[model samples]
Target: MKQLLTLSIVLTCLIVVAWSVSPGSTNAAPEWQSYAPPHWILGPIQGADGSEKIVLNNLDQITRAKIPITAFHFDAPDWQSCTGNLQFRYSDAVLDQMRARNIRGLFWVVPLIGLNCPEYQVALANNYFVKDAQNNVIVTDNFTGHGSWIDYDNPAAVAYWRSLLDSLRARVGNVLGGFYTDSVRPDKRNGVVAYGEAYALDLLDYTRTYVPDGDVVFKRYGVNTPSDAWLNQYAHVAYVNDLPTNFSGMKTGIERVFATTPLMPLPYNEFSGFAKAAPDSETYIRRMHWGAFQPVMENVPFGKQPWDPSFTPQVMQVYRYYAMLHRELEPYLHSYDQAAFEDQTPIFRDMDASRYSARLGNEFFVQYVTDYTPAVQIKLPPGVWINYWNEAEVFKGNRTIMYRAPLGKEPILIARGAIIPMRVYSNLTGHGTGKSEYALTVNVYPIDHSTFRYHDTTNGWLTFDVKGPTRRVALCTLGNVPSEPIIYRIASIAKKPDTVTEQNGAVGINTAWGTPLPERNNKKAVGRNASGWYYETNANRLWVKISTLGTDCPAP
Candidate 1:
């Protein structure tokens, strides 16, 4: 659309861009805000209502969950009666309503053509479908009534699709944030569009041509052999497999291809309730708590997919909160592909700490965790990690403390000056420990905002926002990485329920969050007579006496 030169080749179904060194207009793509990652990863539709109301209503359930609806394939031969105008697929007004509440739509586009559909026929007449080695049209299904495939290599198809996208813009405008194809099959095999990665390359060009300028993604399962450097040329994100929990495998894949890709933290389904039967509250809390540290995160709700009555007040509150957080972190989610290339970290094994983080195409993500317990140390990207949610600055470090943090007790430590309003997780991976405020025993950091810069991760630059949020000590649940930032939010925490804590802020917890076992916030009570106080049995609050620390009063 910017009139930039795009590389075009036939059979390969590919296209490339030549970044004009000469400064052209610096127009940026749009992004979505206030939405959860996704819920129903993929499945068949029942007698479900695809109506905007039905979907949005159902989406209102998970106060904290953002549902990603994958519309049923329109190319199904017998789906005529069920089919609606493409305009109805993504209604602008409907999206506007959802936006008012902070919900996002993850659109799905399958390239396969339908044989019997007049639309597919029109596509072919306009030279749309992809061709085989022999130049014959390749269709998506074997069903007698389906259309042919849109040649990834077909210039005609690209143009038509691009034109179709214009219609989308005219009809829907700025409602959605991200775009991903159900599959990018040049043919029907569902493999990456091949012949030298033509499939993916062309798709990117297509996105630039039509859809809102933003991240374009794809889905992968099983031994997803990405042409790494090659695929990275196009795809900004990938929804990989839902099995084997290969965090390392995922990490390796990302490093080779898009090292900074944002992997969706979940069981792939994004809708399962694993925390339901978690061993303990700490385990449940840790999952969402830990995920909070990652660059990107997606959580599927139990029944918030395609159909539902409506969002209850509780669910609405949570959804609104997460929506606000998502907006705050919007600028950093530039390359969903580069953020979580593969899954290499072991923290994902806890089922509670499936960490997921992403820059809004914004900044670099750097952090250090002291064992996977309830400790964390992440650095904020240089620039003002604008806290879009509350308004504050993050805390810089070199400090420590001890506190009485019991189960269900999260004493929050907000820097009020770290550049953004930070949200502490009750658990990792979007799950909540049902606790309010995370409590830190000891914390040491530069609690000032004088030195941080804003981060832009996409171009890997340190571009400061001229008119960004200027609020200090903003309380936020999301952030954008800028420089070699560091964090100590979960530096040390309680591991159990009802553990003892000294009045001096030393905590002794015993539960599933048993991390940094060596560097606990509060160790066992010391020196008898007024040594330390204990936590109330079976209660979430901690109880400590001041007389316990003796001359160590004030804990130097």
Candidate 2:
């Protein structure tokens, strides 16, 4: 027994040391690659119908309701003057409105030119499209009518495509966030499947120049095949193919998210599905919960608005709760995204093949229930896990347990000794805009020695260190002190500490659990310039407010 225990300790130490020296540990991602928009991207397309009015009204409604959204994705007629024409229809003023709300605009575009589009003749005359064996333009019939696929392999064709996109930029000005490169598949009649990959890759590479830091392309994963691994570099964000609005579709979407994360780190599906009929309230809420935890949370209103009167109020309430939660977790999500880009690690790590669950980096383990039955069996990883919804309810790891997941709640387990960096939820405004200052809240679950390399949007990177022994716990921050204040909430501490000390040798007194620290000149003013700690008896959590106005804590 002693030998096994010593071996385990050595293994744990090695793992910690490895993490401390990993690439993500030493350097922040490049400035351009580190840019992350609000995760809750709203795609307001009701079936095949969408208009500029619909797009603007959806943004207005979401803003009026105080729902969080940072980007609005325009599908079909919203951006196309004639279907498949690479034409910009919405006026620049519409983009101005979006920019005023701090919301970016993503327009749907395709490589095909419909027969009725004026540009079709131009493309055909110039041999810009693929030709059959007889050297005739290969016109294929699709849902949008007959069109010819652009021969992206041809240099002239690619230049013509670039010119069209340039026109869009000139028309829309700078508010264009990116393009949704859908329908890039070439018709089989042309006998060239390789052209589709070129189309997606070239388009993404060129369009990335428009928004150098923002997500430049949202494409379908594996349009060619699952093994087309080269697509990952250009697919800033990828979604599964359109699915039915049913439980089966929900299950398939979850499976695809798990299956594709290895190749495409940022994978998500339309919330509540996008095909067939509208989703029922149960399916919608359940799927929304799953979407909330994914690396990217997107909602496409296929049949009815989430606030429609047909569904129960609980549906909208749950949607609001998860949306707000997703916005608050941007810091946590972006940090892992940086690690994925730098280390090639998946943002959502699959836990079990047979179950619908994944670990969001080392911080969170989430189990998504895909069926009507609320009961679920989950086998946790080795360590202590805390129920995210109810921190008071704890579970021992390396064991299987049947958990009851009632509506509006899913199983989200926070690993013991994990540090999550998040922004204050209440500070968010309409269109998911927030204050300019970097007021952060760090949630720490201290068990043993743990470290988290946290990445912020404005501030580059910071490391959080925590050491929790039998009766003592110490938390400190290292690297790049944030310009704003930080509040640290340390969870799972069973008893009040005898005394808490900061790096400056000032002792922190235990205060009421919910007491708010006073602020002087927008900075936390603890008792006599010494920070303070609070203990919550019910959850066994401690709260500490450290003001990093002009100084940061020394390394622990």
Candidate 3:
């Protein structure tokens, strides 16, 4: 009898799990915000010398991508060979330019402070450097001999570093973003893992002390960098100096952040053999696959290489455009305060795109991980929700559908009659609409016993709308031509009882904290006195996110 009861329990559990599957509401949680950047990292990567600079500005300078970014970061500088030295540090005029162009200034601080420069000597003599077990100050040869590290824990070091950061803050103020640390702190005893985590956390505490509250990011990853899986210590925005696969061990690092807080993953193109320091473009472009999934994207084009296929222009442009789109879709998302859950992989490290696009609050907050090929499903909330990326319409009056992302594409859709600033890129709907348009085939399903209907604005046509039969509905490119295939997803908002009752793990869409939006829309559009999301993604998942939706930063 006990054995039979156990079997019955197992079957019941499966049914509950199946019923619990939200085949309607996407994201389902209130905190999963889109991890896309609105700006692009502009850099003048070099070749051997002048005349050979890989000019990147050659592309469409006037045409803006999804989000507009005016910031630029330099990755390489040959001090020894160059006969001239024109400091490009932040200036008052530069800061003004940033405000005018809506750009921020991010100074990449390399770990080249202690090699042989008098700066290192002066700092060390003043007891500003990290010391060894024998009380001797630590010093080592940075690939760049001029590079050296001071004891981050030392007061003198803190003062000096803050002084530098202050200079930037003074100039850029609201626009000055902290791109802290070039590489992980070097260590041997506890090793890089421990050192990286501890060192990064210390830096955060140190920065928050001076700037009190400002945006900070970590760039130029090292072999000693800590796993992002638990980067509550280091800043959420990562200014990577290495390849994306290197982060494979931390597949869900970004998700982990959004599950709790908002974060960005900005990767620098560190591929260039032109310079002895940077790697080649192929390796850099190859990182695009992983980089695209991140909220932010960037590349290091050093040695002054012109933007070309050899420099991975296609990859860079696609990433830049995609990132912008991701950022633009932010306002409609129900993230930061949303309760997000993940099916944690049981293995050591596994590949999982889980789900990207989820429909909630009449909008599609979607995601596209490594595998854009599998047939996926999404749930929708009552009423209408639209895909803003591509002009695809979906409604949840009835059931759900398994939708597919067009090949190598991500579209942002809006509700049929929703007021939006911009229009989707493509509006094609239905079969034989166009062969090159769709990539992944999506099958929509219903739940409310109603019907699921969607329209394509690409050609301004009503693609399909089902009335009764619970049959499979499919949408894809209509051609036989061989094209690279991938997957994109759609989801719906989970339903709740109509009665106003205590609802856990739920966040309202377009919700604001502190004082709500004003009538005339005449408000400081910033997170002011609030910590909505301070400069970068924090290390919290959805549940904790909703509870602390806004910023807690002390007002200046």
Q: TM-score, each model? A: 0.46, 0.82, 0.47
- The most accurate candidate by lDDT is 2
lDDT of each: 0.32, 0.64, 0.33
C-alpha RMSD between model 1 and the true structure: 15.6
Q: List model 2 lDDT by residue over 376-399, tens digit each.
A: 899888888988878878899988
Which candidate gets the maximum TM-score versus the true structure?
2
List of clashing residue pairs for candidate 2: none
lDDT of 1: 0.32
Tens digit of per-residue lDDT, candidate 3, span 48-77: 212212112312231233234434343343
Write one digit per residue (lDDT tens) for candidate 1, span 1-556.
1222264323233222211221221122101111122212221111123455544444354333532222222222222221211333634555565456444344444444456455666886777766767967765443323445555455666666556556545655544443444433434343543532454455555554443434445554422123433333333345443321123332332232222231222112221121222112232232222223334344432223212234234333333343333323333232232222221121121121222222322222322121224444333433333222222323333333332322222223333222221222333322112121221111112232112232233324232111112111111111332222111122111223333332221222332221111222222231111233332223222322222111111110
Report residue 30 deviation for candidate 1 (angstroms): 20
Q: In what order do the candidates fall by lDDT, top score first?
A: 2, 3, 1
Clashing residue pairs in all predictions, respectively, total: 134, 0, 96
